[model samples]
Each structure stands twice: as structure tokens, then as C-alpha cells.
Target: MPRTAATPEQRAHIREQIRRAAVEVYDEKGMEGTSARAIAVKAGVSVGTLYSYYANLPELMRSLWAEPVAEEMVRLRATVEATPDPLRALRALLEGYANFAFDNPDILRGALLFVGRVQDTALAPAPAAVEFDQMLRDAILAGQKTGQIKPGPAAQIAHQLWAGVHGALALPINIESLDFGSPKQIVAEMIVTLMASVKA
Candidate 1:
């Protein structure tokens, strides 16, 4: 007799298993070295089974980040919204992002930082990422309105701040031999410097 198909819960469980296995494989070997077969082996599932859930390795890799990014955005939105002072809110958002990245280095390197070898626009910024950018833009606009932040395009300022903070957090992780000092301290100092530069 033929076996019954997997239930919705079973499918979700299998998808998560595949995603976790992908993260491990991704950690062991960078994106260029990873393959469906390798992930399937790590997941203890057939290559065909892995393909059923994810269209390709990049898709699986993208899945690894989906939840973490969304969750982080939610937390940031809450933190920004709660702080009344716009300048304080912007500082809080930046610091909160640093803390999250430090806390989840695996996810950071494996998903957030890793741009796949292929140049696919489908892999463009997620909705959560867009939301994150909007959050920064909004915070900057508020601060500028209050004359706490320097006058400039809020979106550009937001992008610059994000780029600076991300570079600081990513450098130590990407280069193990470099004695970059504590990531937390580096990020804190970087945030202060960036904020000060943009101060009115």
C-alpha cells in the first residue's frame, strides 16, 4: 500500500529540519561550497526531498534568515516607538541592532551577511528589511524635525548609519585573525561616532 502524505505540521517540521541543516552546512562551507546534496546529507533527507521544500540552495539559505530578520525588525519597531525622544529612539534602534547581531552571529554570518554567488533580484531585500530602513528613516526625520539631527535626506542618513554600524559588526566576524577588540565595544563606539557626526 502507498504511504500517506505528510500533514501541514509534518511539512513544517521537515522544512525547519532542512533549514537547520542548511545553516550547519553553510557554516561549514561558504555559499559557493554548499550544495543540495550536502544539505540533504546533513538533514538526513534525500536530495529529492530537499528540493521539494526549497527551489534551490539559495532559497534554503534565504529561509534561514526569514524568521530572525522579521523578529529583529519587530523588536526594533517596539524599541523605537517606545522612546519619546527621537534622538534617543535612533540611538536605541542602532544599539538594539548591534546587540541582536552579536547575539546571533551564526545567523548573521550564515544568512544576513552572506550574499549568494548568484546575482538574483529575487534575493533583494525582504519586506522586513524595507521596514527596517523605513524605521531608520522615520527616526531620522523625527530627530531632524526637532532640530536634534543634521539636515539631510532622512533615507540617505539612515542608509549611511546602517552601513557604518553593519561594517563595524561584520569586520571582526569576517576576519578572525584581526584583533578588532570586543564587538560590543566597537559597535558602541561606532554608534556614538556616527550619531555625533549626524548631530545638529
Candidate 2:
């Protein structure tokens, strides 16, 4: 007898299973060692089956992170927009970003690895990354207009804010030997310093 085709639900389940396996392999082997065959073996599927779901390992990794990052950006944007004070809105945005990174360390790590590997000049910025940058720029611009933040190029200020906060969060993750104390407190202090530098 011919086998029945997989239902949508079953297909989704299988896809998720493959993603979980990929994450596990990534954790164990890092980006340099992870491969389609390893993930397929971990997922209990053939390489052909894995290819059918994802064109390649990079595509599989992108699928894992793209939606979560986009959703978080939307939530952060709403948080920023709700605040009447521009300075507070910027604070809220940075805090929200810190919270997301802390809450989803594995996803964050996976995303960083995926991005580092795929940094080709020909590739366009990911939609979520572009949205995140624009959100920061918008907050910075609003603050500058109101004399809450110092006058400067909005894009430059946005980059400073993003880079500073991201460095604070990424340091402990990359250098575990150092005593960085609480990441939350570190980020809060970093925010304060960054805001002070840009304050009008």
C-alpha cells in the first residue's frame, strides 16, 4: 500500500523536531562542526528529508531565529511607542532588548553564530535587524527633537546605543572567566552611562 502524505500538523512537528536537533548539535559542536548530516542524524531523519524541509543548515538556523527576533522587535517597538517621554522610551527599548537577550540565551547565541557565518557583502540586512536599527533611530530622533537627548546624527547615536548595550550583554557570554557580576545591573549601568553621554 502507498503511504499517506503528512498532514500540515505532522509536517510542522517534524520541522520543529529538526530544529531542536540542530540546536542540540550547535550546542555540542559549535558552528564550525555542525553539518546537515549531523543534524539529520540527531533528528532521526535522512539528509534528503532534512533538505526537503530546509535548503541548508544556514536556512535551518535562520528559521529558528527569524520569527522570534521579529516578534520581540514588534513588542519592543510597542513598548517604546507607549511611553510619552522620549528618554523613558529609549530606556524602555534598551531594557526590553536586555530582557529578551537574557531570557533567550540559546536563541541569542544561535543568532550570533548564524550572523557571524553569513556576513557576505552581497547579502541584504535581515528584516528583523533592519527593524531593530530603525526602532533605535526613531527613539533617538524623537529624543533629540525634544531636547531630551543630545543633538547628533540619529543613525550614529542609534549605533552607539545598540553597540554599547550589546557589548555589555555579550561580554559575559563570550568571556565566562571574568567576574562581570549581574548582567541586569551591568546593563542598567551601561544604559545610564550611554544616556548621560547623549543627554541634552
| Candidate with best TM-score | 1
**Residue-wise C-alpha lDDT for candidate 2, range 35-97, written one tens digit per residue:** 888999999999899989976667788777888888998898888878878889888888888
Candidate 1, number of clashes? 0
- Candidate 1 has its poorest 10 consecutive residues by lDDT at 115-124
RMSD of 1: 3.1
Provide the lowest-lDDT 10-residue window in model 2. Answer: 113-122
TM-score of each: 0.82, 0.78
lDDT of 1 by residue, 1-200 (tens): 99999999999999989988887888788766688888999999999999799766667787878888898888899888899899999998889888887888776776767766444435556677789889889999999999999999999999999999999988997798989988888999999999998999
Instruction: Please report the candidate that would top lDDT against the real structure.
Output: 1
Q: After superposition, how far is residue 66 of candidate 1 from its true place, in Å?
A: 2.5
Backbone collisions counted per model: 0, 0
C-alpha local distance difference test of each model: 0.85, 0.84
